[model samples]
Target: MTFHTHHHEQVAEELYDIFESSFDEIFVTDAHGTVIMVNSACEQYYGLSKSDFVGKHVRELEEQGIFYPSASLQVIESKQALEIVQKTDKSRYLHVRARPIFYKNGKLKSVISYSRDLTDLMELSHQVDKMEQQIEFYKRELVQTQSDITGIIVHSDKMKKVFQFIERVSVVDTTILILGETGVGKSRIARLMHDRSSRKTKPYYEVNCAALPETLIEAELFGYEGGAFTGGLKQGKKGLIEKANCGTLFLDEVGELSLSAQSKLLHVLQEKKVRPIGGTKEIKLDIRIVAATNQPLEEMVKKGTFRRDLYYRLNVIPLYIPPLRERREEIIPLVHHFLTVFNERYNRNVEFSPKVFEAFLKGEWPGNIREIENMVERLVVTSERIVTIRDVPFLQQETYTSAHLSLHQKLEELECRLIQEAYEEFGSSYKVAEELGISQSSAIRKIQKYTRGIE
Candidate 1:
């Protein structure tokens, strides 16, 4: 009996030495799911000391997402050995194996679990998947013609259909009305239509009807004779429609046109000719009209704000563009695209962290493509080697609030802050315009408005 007791102690000491020396985590729990003992390796694997894990219930730890699937619990239930991969709360991967110990009467006794960290291997596999996706992206890019939407990225099925629509209508000289929410790439789609058309070699002009003041919209669209207005040019200049003769005229925000201006535009679309404001002779035109607007023109037509005849003329080939949030699949590709573009433009090599990508995928993107472009450019220009969620505080909150204000007032305040900072950083309206995706003229106007008292 004395010899047998000494042998059992020696065997227990050897097992304890093995448990302490083992590189992989060794966790033991009783049949009741209570942790009995854990090795020092738990500290490195889970950022917890042996004391933190010992005496704790395995069920509690599993619920806390320490390491999911609770292998010890599974072994206890099955009364057999089990092996499987598990995920920790920190997104780490582990290859775990658990074995059950049985009593002399075949009742459950204890369960021992061994886990090896597989986080590095899992990360490497994810990288390979990303590389494969990149390869597929490059292949799709190669399939597209450079002249077709030069800088646009179309990966979603909805956008692919939009591209197909552009191709079919490009050969025809029909008027197309592009309807979409703001910043949904209506302008770029118009450009793609012009590029794919027979009018590719001719002049292409984009006129932002909303940006042009109501007082000047008519004169700008239909030209003015010399001395037609107080500050007119000495020599009468051809209006955008006349300038775009034999080509395409993209009237952006066409819903903003005044009633009288809409009348004149309808005449031009019907007669294919324009007469200067103070001139007697009329000039013929052979232009393709492509109009885009975020406003509900049909509703405006019912309200008599927009002309009915003009709406019918412009809506001949109506093309609706889905907003970015509706096409979530395209978000990542666009992020990669904008990152590449801004990196090249700014001579910096910056990348978004995985968390940033996740956030982008889950974002609402109220401003659509323009918002993403601006955000990616801002990150590329301002971030270090990697851009994380910390770089975008606006994502955490809907709007900046310093006082009680209406939504419009809040937006104006935000715009004022952005314009001010952009002006300070770039020191030029053109750069600020480019940074904010607005026109240089608009940028100048805003800079004057927002930076009125700044030194």
Candidate 2:
């Protein structure tokens, strides 16, 4: 327990040298798994210095809930080795493997665990999940915007949370249901959830249940064996469920599935087994089910347009992605992200004039990220530089002020609207003015003049 012993010091020095070189934490724990020696790397990893971790229990510093104490304890008492996730106050997921040491008499002495922080991986998984949701959202928005599908953008906190939700669920093996409006990105979230899960490295197969012919739905999902059904492949075809083995299967518009398909899909999900069309034996496949729908499934189930049992099965982790209108705060970022994307695609640098962004905030992005992406793409293809609000035909033609107001008093109402919006958006006069393409002093004067009556 002293600072050093000559023999242990020599060995500890070598270990410290190794620890200093390592990016991960490496510390020595005593027989009780309490910190006996701390390395600089270990300290830095835990946001502490050597002096602080000298006496703390290693397990206490990690998330005990993530581990099975009995299994971890066995590694120390029986000289076993085990790997697990370590959750701590500072970090959520750390890849740790504990290796135990034994005496000549076969008695266990102490255990050493190498722990690597993987919070970034979890975050990355989350990002992939987010993008997945965004992409799907963009797809629906693409159709809704009546804008170009090649161009899509998402900039909304609501959409970002959708992404975060997808990321959180990527690693989990469970059935996920994505719900939103017609133009919302449910399918994209499904792909995202798949790409970030344990199955990310595997294939992602997608099919739209609504689009498939009702008669062929079963064959497409479960595949048919040669001679099993008339006109079936001679060699037999692998179903979408089978094709998604060890990966993710995205069933879009699940609400549209026929009762037969729903029954089959539900069985596949529950049993983790698939049957080929006309095949006698059921085949097992490793699959993650990601289902999506724009329909109000619960309402439909109540009305008997959709199945109640299938609804419950797919709703294990229900993700309700809010529409673009809710997260207007993300409009600018989404615009920029889309602008950059289109700029690269078309080799054009399209700049947004002050009015364009103002117009963006004013306009409703019901199509969500997809609509923005299309508009940005249009700018890329049609215009070159200084893409102004006028360049957007929608902005030029659309009515900005409330439609209920008469034209005569609308200007005064519009001025009030702009000032109020700027104040709320910027939280300060200077920021609003910058966004509004005005001087801070002018912005202050305007606010002073306009609010004088109310104040």
Candidate 3:
């Protein structure tokens, strides 16, 4: 019996040593809520000595305000475990867990509690939340910057759908072909695609195929060797394709490419390499192609004027922009956008009258966004504070006033004007019929009727 008592005392001493060395604050209280034991960590966390709490009732500690609403007392009363966040008088945060200890007779024996400091973790969580908010703010700013850089002003459902498509395709590296009528902002859309893409920081090259002569376009696109032809630069020049390496190349009026040029372009697209004229070496390229045309490439393909294979390669991702007449809802917003732009450019604050808006909304925008921008710039530079109907150009005034006519009369007048213009330009009923996509008999009858009225 004496040896067993000594061994038990040695075991108790070892447990006390372990309890003192624990990193977490640990305390034990009797069933009556009197403090019985506490670890050394409590002194550093709560600024209290073990002697200050040992043998003292929890209520006494609460009255002295050493800690508020004692967790051990609650666990004793409820006979269950409880978790809480407690703050000390020294401005330290603690995550505390208290559990009731039971005896062999199924009766409560004591309460044990554990607490860990939570100050650093809580501070880190707050910092992360602030960083997330800042990231969201910068994302919104980037979106606005992209819109401004791309010159995209959209409101109508038709154009909204187009914008959505642009966003969806910006991440891809596939070739994109933009189909739209002349002056319908196809070039702007191409730029928008480039701006939204991951290659935005790289160089962007634009070439108007129709603007360059057929004899010069091949050399312009494929570049040339030193002294390859008359008037050529000594060092040779880098073609737009080479200039757009690892970036985007916008080919405007791609349908205007001659057959030989189209064949060369197709080879480049297939092999991702460009060979300069009169040069033996071919330079490899990593470029995204964005092509635009006012003409129908599919019809050109059917007529054997455009290579079917090249058309397929360019048409991998086709986006069609509707004309201004189909999206009237966008006119006012576009006008306002241009108004703000020109107002700043010319340093004027001109405004349009209600009647002017009425006239603008009613007229057919044949030249699309380009014409609107030109008109707004004209008004900003020429008109006074408030632009009235009379401030519009004489030719446009006639166009605007004609919108007041009945729908039937408007259609008839437009048809007559078109027929007369086609006859004058082509000078033959067969040519007029072909130009207007109508039968020869219909063209002859319409031309005669409109001409007779003119006489």
The number of the candidate with the highest lDDT is 1
Q: Order the numbered candidates by lDDT, best leading.
A: 1, 3, 2
Model 1 worst lDDT run, 10 consecutive residues: 142-151
Residues 1-455 of candidate 1 have per-residue lDDT tens digits of 99999999999999999999898989999988899999888888888778878899875675455765467876876778976555566656566778989999999999999987756643444455457547646644434332222246665899899999889999999999999998898887897788688888788888999898998887888999998888788887789989999999999999999999999999999998999898889999999999999999989999999999999999999999999998886676677666766787699998654446656777899999888888888889888786655577665544478578988998898898798666544446778899999998898789767754221
- Stretches off by above 4 angstroms in model 3 are 1-150, 394-455
Poorly placed runs, candidate 1 (over 4 Å): 1-150, 397-455
User: TM-scores of the models, in the given order?
Assistant: 0.57, 0.53, 0.55
Evaluate model 1: give its lDDT.
0.79
lDDT scores of the candidates, listed in order: 0.79, 0.66, 0.78
Best by TM-score: 1
| TM-score preference between candidates 1 and 3, better one | 1
Indicate the residue-level lDDT of 448 in model 2: 50
Q: Rank the models by TM-score, top first.
A: 1, 3, 2
